[model samples]
Target: MDDKKIVRAWIAYDWANSAFATTIMAAVMPIYFISVAGGTDGSWSFTQTAAAIVVALLSPLLGAIADHSGKKVLFLRVFTVIGAAASVGLAFVGPGDMWLASIIVVIGMVGFGAGNTFYDALLNDITSPEQREKVSSLGYAMGYLGGGLLLAVNLGMILGWESLGLPDKTAASQISFVSVGIWWFVFSLPLFKKIKDPQSTNKSRIGEHLKIGVQRLGETFSRLKKYPELLKFMVAYWFFFDGINTIIVMAASYGTTIGIEETDLITALLITQFIGFPATMLFGKLADRLGSKKMLYSSLVTYLIIVLLGYFMTSSLHFYLLACLVGLVQGGSQATSRAIFSKLIPPGKTAEFNGFLSFTSRFFSFGGPLVFGLVKLISDSSRIALLAVAFFFLMGILLLTFVNLAKGEKEAVQP
Candidate 1:
């Protein structure tokens, strides 16, 4: 098993799935639902979130099944195809069918989110402990790069709606949605071609693996005490990364709620993604040299600063500045954290712990929007929402301070 091929496959998955993140979730879909489909409120947004959460909740069991059955790649392919179909289905949603749009969004969200658990778990099988961060960051970087390029093309087609020969704004949006599906499915083929199934530790038959998935999940939860530091890291990830996800999800919306132009927001987001490419790679190297703990601490500090600066950013120029700041630390922080945990977990239990971590991380996401919504509702301010994210970073930074990285590693693999 060559590491580079695995790395290429992982990065390819990132590019494939990022079409959902950039085009659907972050870019066009929300705007389309609200403006084109006539969704009156945040229901569509909430529904999209619910879909992601439902899939994340199901991740541990599915991951266990994948591990027990050696079916990670197969599951990835199935879910990727499902997500691609749902994404393409968006083009069919029409003028009066907000519900249909919501349905498509949820379907795509579930498939994309669910597929990621298997894709992420494959990391454990492919790379050695020392190689995890670099490889993970490589994937994240390529994701940003590929997503940015495609989004730029889609954004042009969208902003220049009439000239593109689409029927209307709605039609253009619909076509954009389908294009993401095509992009995702087309790119996903490379990973499927290049990567083989992860070797299963369990010799169970498929039926037995299905049965064991539930039991393994129970055992995984029951054994959390055996990996205290891993548990602690998961908790920290839940707090910090939830903040990251929420901010990414909500920031553009927040800008819109307060009168920021859609073009400016989209451009800023593109900037953030492109900047994140080299920035993550740089951070990975820095983490290797300075230590993952120190790197994450630095990244958190940067995040805290960004949130604080966001408080005063009332202009489009300031928003772009903030985007640059986000690019500086966002991928690096996330990549470093993934690498750190990958190093800390027991080999055979990577998916188990990663699933547990994924579940917890996702669980924290539901609240940020609600909190931001409340802050906007009560204070009539988006600044409060921006500031509210800082609390998660504060909590994560505090928890991380309690973690002794080298000591944690010793405990995880003492045998």
Candidate 2:
């Protein structure tokens, strides 16, 4: 495939999967889990924490195997199928099915997280170094647009179900799950068709590959001291990205706790999605001109402000304002982090290193939401929990200051 086609196919996967992120993770499913399943806010957080731990344990092994076998695309397809299938299964869940719902959600989230490790590794295969920031940003921008578009239609279905001939809001929400699954599968075709695999000489049998993957993962950990800058960046990413993930996953539930209406919460999320599309693209251009690290720092500072805003939020309007603020920096921060990490990975080890990236991000990510839930449980205030998340951003900023991007890039280029 041509470079243009490959890049577009790669970006298309973001569009394909982000429906899951927006609909299942951020908007619809959390509310459904609460209203229909009788789950509390802490239960939602715990569900994500449980799923994150499972993915964190498996990603490195799977990533290393894919790298060794040169089957990254195969792994991507397998996990995407798992996620989409589970998403479809969610539509069948009914009232008081919390256990079933939680199990399906965990399966779906594991797929999403695991599939993303390979998708991110593909950045190294598909784009030149100079083009990575823009390409990565474009993927995220497309994600915002795709997710927002579906959420808008889903929102209409929920709000106007009577006119649409649906039975009730619950039925409408269930149908939205099926829509996201279909959207994910249909949009994923382009990437499956267009993106070619990177060539590799290591063609071991499955059993051998598993053993080798474990060995390689162990070696990578033992050699971490040699890549100090990359290690620092990963630690920094783990801290702030945990806070970011917690916010994305917990925002809807938190809104419910604070008396924000469901419609308003979904509307605020939709607004964030649309705003994020263009804002992410703008950040891409800015990163190209100003450097990824500088843009990342700016985003961290904005996140700190957003966390502070979340602490004081009371009305739906305040929720909307905070959502907009999150939109401004969320994609920028994540996209630049991916682009920067791409520059640091060792040659022929993109998937393996990305697995470690996923592992660190996910393992440490268990902290933010777990802490948030604990704080909420102890203090009986989601407000205090929001305030507690600010510490993550602050710690991330401090760790980021110590990372030498130049040194990391230099290490990556060495033979």
Q: Whole-model Cα lDDT per candidate?
A: 0.82, 0.90
Give the winner by lDDT: 2
Off by over 4 Å in 1: 198-207
Model 2's number of clashes is 0
Q: Per-residue lDDT tens digits of candidate 1, residues 86-193?
A: 999998887778888887888888888778887877777777777777788888888888888888888888778888777677777877888899999999987899
* TM-score computed on alpha carbons, candidate 1: 0.94
For all the candidates, what are their Cα RMSDs to the real structure? 2.0, 2.0
Question: How well does each candidate superpose onto the true structure, as a TM-score?
Answer: 0.94, 0.94
Please report how far candidate 1 places residue 44 from its true position, in Å.
1.7
What's the C-alpha lDDT at position 129 in model 1? 76
Candidate 1: residue 169 Cα off by (Å): 2.6
Over 4 Å off, model 2: 38-42, 199-203, 373-381
